[model samples]
Target: MSSNTFKQAAEAARSKTSAMNKQSSEAVSAVKNDFLHTPVMRAALPFINGGISGMVATIVIQPIDMIKVRLQLAGEGGTTGPRPSPLSVTKDIIAQGKALDLYTGLSAGLLRQAVYTTARLGFFDTFLKGLSARAKAKGRDVTFVERASAGLAAGGIAAFIGNPADLALIRMQSDGLKPVAERKNYKSVIDALSSIVKSEGVTALWSGATPTVARAMALNVGQLAFFSEAKAQLKAHTQWSPLSQTLTASAIAGFFASFLSLPFDFVKTRLQKQHRGPDGKLPYRSMTDCFIKVAKQEGLTRFYRGFGTYYMRIAPHAMVTLIVVDYLGWLTQ
Candidate 1:
C-alpha cells in the first residue's frame, strides 16, 4: 500500500478503538449509577444493626469496662493492694452478681447505644449532606479536607448533645443503680438531665467533656476517612461481597480508633467515677489532675488494664454493626 493510504488506515483503526473505549466506559457508568440510585427497601437496616451490635458488645464487655473504670480511678501511683488482672476482675464480677452482675447495666447500655448510634449515624449523614449542599451553593466541590472538617465538627456536636446520656449510662453502669435509688432517679434522658441539674448542678452533665470530645474527633475521622478509603479499595481490588467488605473495613477502622482513644477513655472513666469531696466537688478536679493522679498512683500500665477486652469488644462490634447495617440496606433496597 502507498504510505498515505497506510497512515489513513492506522488513523481509522485508532478512532474505532477510542470509540469502543468511550462506549465501554459509559456502559459501566450507567450500571453503577443504576445500582446506586435504586431505592433500597431497608435503608434503616444499618442503623438498626449498628445499634443492636453495639449494645450486645457493650453488655459482653461491661464487666471489663467496669474494671477499667476502677483501675483508672486508682490513679498512676497504683492500687493500694494486689492488682487484679482482667481475668480476675471478670471472675470477681461473676462471683459478685454472677451472669446478672456481668450484665449489670444492660438496659442503660442498650439505651445509650440506641441513642448514640442513632444520633451519630443520623447526624453524620445529615452533616455531610448539608456540607455538600453548601459547597454546591458556593459553586465548589467538597474536598477531602472539607469532608474531614465536617466530620470533626459533626462528631463534636453529636458528642456534646449526647454527653448527658453518656454520663448517666456510665454512672449507671459503674454504680449499677437507677438514679431514684441513688436519690438521683433519671426516668429518661431528659429526666436525667433535670435531676442532675437539680442536684449536682448543670455542669455535672459535662463531667468529662474534654475527653469525650477528643474521643469523638478520633472516632469520626477514623470511621469517615478510613471506612471510605477501605470500602473503595476493597471493592476495586477484591472479589468479596459488599457485606464482607463493609465489615472488614469497619472492623479495622474501629479497632485502631478505639485503641488510640483508650487512654482518653481511661481518664474519662476515672474522672466520672471519682467522688466529690465532702463539699461536693470532683476529687481529681481536672483532666490534668486526673492524669497526674493516675500516673502517680497507678503507673503507666494501669492505663491499659482491660486492653484485651477493649479490642475484643470493639473489633466484633464494628464488624457486626457495619455488616448488619449494610445487609439491612441491601434488603431494603
Candidate 2:
C-alpha cells in the first residue's frame, strides 16, 4: 500500500476509536444520571452509603474493637479479677493464636453494620429532613432535642433489627474465652447463627437485645446528634473548612459516643456472652438484673474500665464512617 493509503487507514481507525469512547462515556453518564434521579435510589442511597461506610470503618477499627471487648470482659463476675490494659489484651490475643485472631467475628461485625448502620443512618437522615422541613415551616432551626430524638428513634429501631447479627458477633468474639473443649468454634457468621438457632432457638439470636438497643440509642444520640450539631455549630462559629469541621465534629461525637454507650455495651457483651449454665440457668435474668448485679458485684466503675480503648475504637470508627458517608453523599450529589 502507498503512504497516503496507509495514512487514510490510520485516520479512520482513530476516528472509530474516538466514537466508541464517546459512546461508552455517554452510557456511563446516562446510567449515573438515572440512578441519581430515580426516586427509589435517592431514598435508598443513605442506607447503602451508610452500610458501605460502616463496613469500611469496621475493617479499619476491628483490632481496637477487639481490644476493647477483651478489656471489658477481663474482670468478669467480680471486682478482684484481672485488669487488662489494651496492650496486654493485644498481646494476649496474639499469643493465643495469630494476629488474625484479633479479627474474630469480623463476618458478624460486617453483617451487623449492614443492618444496624444502614438503618440508623438512613432513618436519621430521613428524620432529619422531616425535622428540618418542619422547623423551616415554623420559621426556626432544628433544636438539639429534635436531633437527639431522631437519633434515639433511629438507633432503637436499627439495634432491634440488627440484634441477631450483634449477638452472633459477641458470641464469636467471646468463644475463645471458653475452654477449648467447650468452645462452639463458629466458622463464620452463618455458622454462629445456625449453631445458636439449633442449640437455643431463634430467639437466642437476640440475646442481650435490651442492652443492645439501649447502647444503640445512647451511641446514636452521642454520635449522630452530636456530630450533626457540632458540625453545624462549627460551620456557623468557626472559620474552619468543611473537612476540619467534619473531623472536629466527629472527634467530639466519638468521645461522647464512647462515654455514653460503654456501660450498656459492657452489659450487652456480658449478656450475649453468657449461655445457660449446666444448671439450665443464665447468669443475669434481664437487662435490669445485669445492671444491678454488675454494680453490686463488679462495682460501678467497672462499666468504664476500658474507656481509653473504647474511645480509640469508637472515635476512629465514627470519624471514618462519617467522613466516608459525607464523601459518598457528595459524590452522589
Off by over 4 Å in 2: 1-24
Which candidate's lDDT is highest?
Answer: 2
lDDT of 2 by residue, 176-258 (tens): 88889999999999999999999999989888999999999999999999999999999999999999999999999999999
Against the hidden reference, what TM-scores do the models get? 0.70, 0.94
> What's the residue-level lDDT of 29 in candidate 1?
86
Total clashing residue pairs per candidate?
A: 22, 0
Model 1, 1-333: lDDT tens per residue? 899999999999999999999999999988876765565513443445556655665665665556555444432345667766667766766775666665554555667677676566655555666788999999986666765676577667767776776787666555542234654433454565566678788888888888777777777766655665577689889999977888888877777667677777777777765566689777687788877877777677776767776666566666655665566456544
Off by over 4 Å in 1: 1-64, 67-71, 74-80, 129-147, 176-198
In order, the Cα lDDT scores of the candidates are 0.66, 0.94
Lowest lDDT sum, 10 consecutive residues, model 1, at: 177-186
